[model samples]
Target: MEGNHSAHGAFILLGFSDRPHLERILFVVLLTLVGNTTIILVSRLDPHLHTPMYFFLTHLSFLDLSFTTSSIPQLLYNLAGHDKTISYAGCAVQLCLSLGLGGVECLLLAVMAYDRFVAVCKPLHYMVIMHPQLCLGLVSLAWGCGVANSLIMSPMTLWLPRCGHRKVDHFLCEMPALIRLACVNTAVVEGIAFILAVGIVLSPLAFILVSYGYIVRAVLSIQSSSGRHKVFNTCGSHLTVVSLFYGNIIYMYMQPGASASQDQGKLLTLFYNIVTPLLNPLIYTLRNKEVKGALRRLIWGNLHLRKTI
Candidate 1:
């Protein structure tokens, strides 16, 4: 629209900032925020991180990194560069990573819920069952599912016809947005995507609910009120996270097709997509006394070593 009216084939992702001053400020702030999170999470990798809970937490941190990376960097580039247009290939990558990681997080959250359930309900058998090999496989499968989904959905969504306007309202490509943009009859895409998501998300969520149901049952079986209180306190943080994640996603997706308000759509997208990933590590780690203790000891050890030397 500016200098090259008919030169570029790609569409610009104007992103969060149109004002120059606001864009620079937000860029600095967001970069600092994400950078701090990455620094803290990666620095925590030690023998202390060998526990099943920490193992999963590390993977969650990694997913969060990838999730933000998929969307944020491109937005930054668009904000700084004169040409805001993204190539078809770059757009495809955005769609893949966004959905892939979104799906991965859903599965991983269920796994974490199950982990908590076992720790609370079946403490006696926790170590024997949630062993290293099984944990590794689940994390590996999480990554694998995301990668495979990228391969399938990216092409499936992008390869569709582009008869009308090619502009995407979102800062990054999302399924609903891309599907709306597609020229093909989306019946098959809708059905296949629905079934695929239901199997991955709902099935695991059902398993998590069952796990927590048993967990609650176990808690109720406690004779002492104090014992019940302790168990409830231990699981409360995780329950809140699961509730928020699913609640936002369900509200966004399960709406009546007739009521597709764009403002509400963007708000809901921000809630689960941007906010939840940021909160995961902070919530889970703060809730766990072990991780806190490990962090404190790690700091103290470094301080003591410096003094000794």
Candidate 2:
């Protein structure tokens, strides 16, 4: 075990160093952190935002925040200066957190899709169907599944014998990049990883699609055009978020092995980790009138309280 740990004590994250300008752009991760934090705070503070949708959204924001934080700071540090080396332990933690949080987001998004489906298709029974207990259970299950996935995959990936190769082609300690470092053939491990990826990534995506199918039908059945428009408006933000998240995830994880281009993989990972989290808050806040109104109320109330003081 000591030999294994010492074999590759540290990894050099060769992230976009060739394109120095791109590193400057990645500082936007700070905005991603603030945006997700605001979503969580606003959702908790505002009574009007206390609904099933926002309940799930708060968790989602937390997952995005965690997912981005797991690796971005090190990545930014690597980009900013000469020291790009990360300890083996740091890489392991990053891998576990990123994998677990990512899995949680995938499942949480599907849960959100189900929440939307209930609200749209069973409007009268929405509360009864998606009660607080069920919401909690769903979230707990997502979290549990994600943690299990990380426990299973992180150890397996890190355990692979690197045989002295310590340079990770990508920014973070992602599974694919680490797998490439192994001295032995990784076909069996990759197979297991692929199966797990399908369960974590593809299954939730399929469930989201099915939920949205029912939602679309229910929206179309509305007799009034205005009614239909309202329903679509409520769902559009979630749909956009799902597209952005899942598309990049699928491209990154689904194709495991040498066939995937390292350059393309790095770029996709950057977009997925950095841009997706940043856009999530903008998508939810800008397109969601309920959230916008809640923000306005929260801000005004804060200002009014200060004036009274």
Candidate 3:
């Protein structure tokens, strides 16, 4: 069945358009975008930091970069202007990309946890176990699964009988908000969404928990306090990231948007999309000595080269 809405149909993203203060949200989005970009560059430029862990972090940075970029700019535009309309095609694209990147991040976080697990549980074998080919394969698999999920979910959600109800009650074209606009009974679609949410969110979360369970066991076996501390620092940033990402996600999708008011949901989505990406670099660079050292060397090395010039 063809969508009654034309391709040119527009959605009014009620994104902070209701709020008197919009500058702060714009500032936060731009700042976080820059921070995520910097993490990607720093991870790439520092040769000493080129390990499986940092490799995953680089992938993560890139995911956050693309993920936030997919929606935040449009969101900022809506926040800044009285004209908050998003073209139907634009909304579709936003939904697809955001969902894909978000799924990738969720799965990739679990993969990172496994990377930490192997590093801590099998130190001597870490290099051999997490080889270049395996790392590439894992990252590729993550991207593939993410894209596949978006392919499935986005089209179905967009094709829903919206009956021209086009005002999306959030800053972005998120799945839940779009779903809420459907005019027809959306039980099956919502059910599928719930299942996909479980697969994308909970499964990865469970894997992370299991990986950390093994990690904790291994850390407990270490007699040296310094050894334990070193291991803890390595995993802490990732653990924090997982907690933030999954916690909001699980709550948001727990029962088909029953958990929060539209306003509250927007704030939660804001945290996940904006605040989390901003904090990711800060968390890793601050808590992990290796990233900090690499960043410092990169900064000083640039300065020294400039002096020569």
**Regions of candidate 1 where Cα sits further than 4 Å from its true position:** 1-9, 14-46, 224-226, 252-259
Worst 10 residues of 3 by lDDT: 1-10
Tens-digit lDDT track of model 1 for 1-309: 422332224755654443455455434435435643653554465576677876776677677667666776777777766766787778877778877887787788788888888888788999998998999888888778767766776677776665644676666666666666555577776666666667666777787789889998888788999888767665776787788777765554444122355446555565565566667656765775666666777778889999999
The alpha-carbon lDDT assigned to residue 157 of candidate 3 equals: 82
* lDDT per residue (tens digit) for residues 117-160 in model 2: 99999999999999999999999999999999999988888888
Q: Is candidate 2 or candidate 3 better by TM-score?
A: 2
Cα-based TM-score, every candidate? 0.84, 0.96, 0.95
Task: Judge candidate 2 against the unseen true structure and give its global Cα lDDT, from 0 to 1.
Answer: 0.89
| Best-matching candidate per TM-score | 2
Stretches of candidate 2 off by over 4 Å are 1-8
Worst 10 residues of 2 by lDDT: 1-10
The CA lDDT at 149 in model 3 is 90
**Model 1 weakest lDDT span, ten residues long:** 1-10
Write down the lDDT of every candidate, Cα atoms only.
0.68, 0.89, 0.84
